[model samples]
Target: MGASDTAVAMSTKDSSEASLGATAAGPTPAAGTAALAIAQARVSQTDLTGLTLSGRYLVTRKVGQGGMGAVYEATHTLIGKRVAVKVLLEKYAQREAIVKRLKQEAQLASSIGNEHIIDITDFGNTDDGRTFVVMEFLEGESLAECLARETKLAEQRILRVGAQVASALAAAHAKGVVHRDIKPENVFLLKRKDQDFVKVVDFGISKSLRQSSEEEEAVRLTQTGMVLGTPLYMSPEQARGDEDLDHRVDVYALGIIMYEAASGRVPFSGANYLSVISQVLNEEPKPLRDIRPELSEEFEAIVAKAIAKNRNDRYASATEMLDDLNAVIEDPTHSTERAKITGPRRLLPKAPKIPRIAWAIGGAGIAVAAVTIIVALLMGSKAKKQLKNANANPPAARADAGVATVAPPDAGEMVPAVETIKLTIVTDPPGADIFREEELVGKSPQTVEFVKNNKEVNVTAQLPGMEGTTSINPLERKDGAEVKIRLKKLKGPPKVIIKKTGETGPQKQQGGTTSHTGGELGTNPFAGSGTVH
Candidate 1:
């Protein structure tokens, strides 16, 4: 019999003896003895120190405890290898649904032979009906701890970490497993062989997408209308409790994680869980560029596509997203066309109106000039005819109309005036250096007049720590155009550099023991336990 079974038998025997002693005494004494027996049984169920499991694992001490189960640091008796043993709490061991889910977590994780995923070695129940799973012990802190210490991650580090995670997710998705609960707390950073390696843990809420005739009924742990993911990173479809979910939900969650890593904040947040879910369902995240402008446009585009509201719009698979990330890592300048955002409407300055008097005066002047030119032409023609006739008949002189003839000035001298328009450039945090066509123009918030041209103009804005450049197309109206550039502050060097610990071998150490009660499941069903068995 298993350890749990033996403990149950012992508890039964103790309760029987207490009942007999109470029967020999009064009814009040019998009730008191029965209460004491129940308390003792509860304590015995949790006290598994120095106990042996399956004749292989020897429990030394408890490492972690949570709502679902408690994790213990154990050693294999024969091999003397350290391992982590996760036992389902006795209170929840009786729940068929919870037990099935825990078993599924062990079975599914063990099947995937991925280096980035936690490895499960064995899983079974104790003699006393307490289920447990044994996995390879790891010495490292979770990504959650790292994020808490370092508010944000470096760009290169984020990409490297994201790529590794995507690769793991790709493996899982290929095998028909969708990790429904993916968060920082579930990602572990282990120091292995002088290198930082990522290990994705906690597949307790993961769903197997493969449909088999025998497992159809067994895969119904998550019923319709039941939500099962973290609200902060939950996708819209998941938040809505959609029954038909796939690997894209994991993609969305990864995008959220990446967003936080880059900006030190999640796109959507609220005072409560419901409010956060509501925001995820109805609100659109603020553009990433607004938070970190120095990030390449291509990188932002990749993230935007991953977190698209519609699953169809997101990357079809994790591999596709990984490819884009690889491209960005190779060349930061690479960019892809994305949907444009028409920002909030601004109240533009009203255009100055041309007075009617000016128009009337201009019109009168044009008419007078036209008349003078016409009269001059008539006189010139008359003089030309007279000269022609005189030249023909040199001997005959006409003295009735004596007039000196003059030729009109050269037509080339009358040139049309060039038209010029005003171009204005403004920066978000004003006083940035402005450049036009490689020529250094004055500082921003300045206006200059240039001859109107049909070609597009390229303008660049630069400051000590912020910079932005854009092309302004030719304006169709004579009022010209005003261009506003929003400059992004450049990201400084990383505050912390995560290095692999030099300790190559694992130390024989154990965690503190803490008794956990109740059967309530939090956001992370298996919070303390790395993986549920």
Candidate 2:
């Protein structure tokens, strides 16, 4: 009742629910509305329990009812075997035309000779003029019931059910019988051979392509101005009342069923039948992956093709669709999606053109420089996040240089508009506070990143009662690099040396490195040293 994406399931109590709209006989708006109304009102009102049919089978309680009629469980008096008897209501049974069509349905289904199809054993009219077709009494419930209980079928079960339905449909198509109505409600599921087995039912609106008999040739079953099939599963062509509908219609409907099984809902729905039909004719269904992204791309593609707007775009027939389903069932990895994306592709803008001379001279150096710059810029932005606590990462001295891996932009991966680099700060004797560009970052053993501008950045490490170290390593180095700092124990507490009034130059320490006057860390040796030449 909401919109196309909202699925409104039919009543699970119905064994077979069908929707009738415009048929090959071009339909007017009124006809579409009227047909849907009639289809919706197909509930059985009369109870025929305890009646003997054709003096052969004794009618029992009604099992389920649907758009066309009610199905009853009955037993043959002589054989004492139970069977399902589908009987037309008196109003429809008395109509010679409707009766002939029902008989044709039995003939068409029986002729298919597929095990997945319901087995129609007999078709006869009783003394009361009630027409019925008897078939094997299935002990399991319809797919509608299963979905109502479970919501969505498992993946393998979906494929299994789809394969079986396709097999049945292939057989029907080969026999020139096109099942115009295929939906969850019409598919019966039961345990057979210890596996989930499917039996396709409800051939009331089926159309036979071949005229194998005089009765079939003389009286066409499909009526004029009366389109028939379930609105939820109708193909676009069928919704349009196209006169030349073919087996692909069944293929499309089956795809919808499979889609429903995977997503637990139909792609289209509406408040009334006409609205649904309108969507079928005018709207494209949401992609199968949109609702359930985990579904394999290959599987989604198969369903997408089945429901293509153009009939030719769909599977040639149910057999063709069955082949793909079988392949998936046989080998889980078998898929067409890989072929769709085969070969290399670039996901970003092309890198700037580098001159041949530059590559010949220092290509690796240039690449490293770019990565470092990128890392530096990134670290600059994240500077505030770095823990300022001096002892954040208690550094442990290592016998060998600690190595850290820096990931550069992937090959063919688009480079961001801005490049960045990262520098890992690790110090010996641990717990030293680190400062980048004179700003407090986390303690040693931390990594800092920022945009790689050409400007030089100075790094400093500090520890109490020890001489801190500061160094400007390089503009850039090859991808994986580390900045290791070694701090020395202070000789004693700071010596407050008073400078003479005219003294200006820095007072050099005994070791050659000059410590800052504040007793934190020494500045870079190059600082304030002017005009060496």
Candidate 3:
């Protein structure tokens, strides 16, 4: 339960995306095998056949039963939506004891509006006095199930799951809740028709600071001696039964889960649950990169931080952890710098012996050296030209006009030829991005210098998770008529709501047509291929 064994299967699973309501039947362990022992032992005698609730949610069948409760797949009468409802067995619901706690679980989980966290819409008791919690019907497999099919995922996919779970944890943590049980089984990876969604489940053992510590509430509903969480994912404090554990426990668990997802192995394992707990407390698991050397150092670092033994060493909140994961995904190189240089900086050659302006200011000694270097370059050019001139003419009658003359060099030469048209990248919160002619460029605050004069200049700036602004105009300035652009960050995609005069839309575009794609706004239609200064 704490450390997953199914992760070994993730690597070999089919790559094609599954569809909504799709269920892949994985191989099941023999009933008496060690792997299936705990699951089999927990099977309940409670019969849910023909049980109906609210005259609508029809109990289909028992999906699984565990130490906490029994889960069932049911159908909603009106919407015909399939949902899973967890019901407390008769033993736990003897006196409406578990009913109140399950209600609290629903309330606490409902407060968390994050999509990654499971949605609990209704909670009630049946005519037979059994308490039940109705949650969204998940069509996808649990992380454990997926891991069982394939232990390790590609780096990109792992990052996607990590980012999503982090967001779920963040939402839960912000509401003063801690999901004491954070493991692969509790993290469901649901696939819609076109995309996958992450939903965290099983908050039955969750800790909420908002709940009162009265005598009734002080006594936990779970039976004593029944270890609440999977041992491998439990933090040291949690394993020690420390009542003061906070969100840090979840941090440690998230790290363990991510580590396993990447390497298909847990950081720590033992012959039995007790030994595993002992090792978790006394030993540090080997680094993930040790198992998969190809793993990014930055990713390893993030896992290390999340699994830090000391709570203080872990990220302060789930959002912080999520941000780190997103950063790692967005820029894999951020984790480490290689001996080789990359990006635009690599274009330059070895450094010059003296700076460019050295000839102007250096003393006579260095000046002579610089002059010699320049003269050598000139001599080489002269030789080439002389060869051409000799070929063109038999002998140069000492020419009165030695060389062709051209107009003075353009001012554009003094500046970088890559001068991008100046356009302010306005954001709701200002940010930087490169854009041209209402199209995305690669840099911000850029200048297009190398281009010839009178060329059309389209400049734009783009910021991630925000709207981008672009301007298209000819860059035929005489001296310096500054093109002042004011870009505003749009709250949503650029919308075209024709307001009489002062009605505001998500985008405040001064000019150009508007359209939306993927929750983003774009002004101006796509332009034909042409160079923009």
Give the candidate number with the greatest lDDT. 1
- Over the stretch 248-342, how does candidate 3's per-residue lDDT look in tens digits? 89988999999899989888788998898887775666656658889765676677667866565467778877776776564444556322211
User: Residue by residue across 81-170, what tens digits does model 1's lDDT show?
Assistant: 999999998888887777877888899888888998999999988767889999988899887888899988877677777877888899
TM-score per model over all chains? 0.59, 0.54, 0.55
Q: For candidate 1, list the clashing residue pairs, or say none.
A: 2-127, 3-127, 4-127, 4-128, 5-127, 5-128, 102-533
How many clashes in each structure? 7, 23, 28
Better of 1 and 2 by lDDT: 1
- Residue 14 CA displacement from its true place in model 2, Å: 39
How do the residues 391-441 of candidate 2 rate in per-residue lDDT, one tens digit apiece?
134245343534222233344543234444444455655567666554555
A best-first ranking of the candidates according to their lDDT comes to: 1, 2, 3
RMSD of candidate 2 to the truth, in angstroms, is 26.8
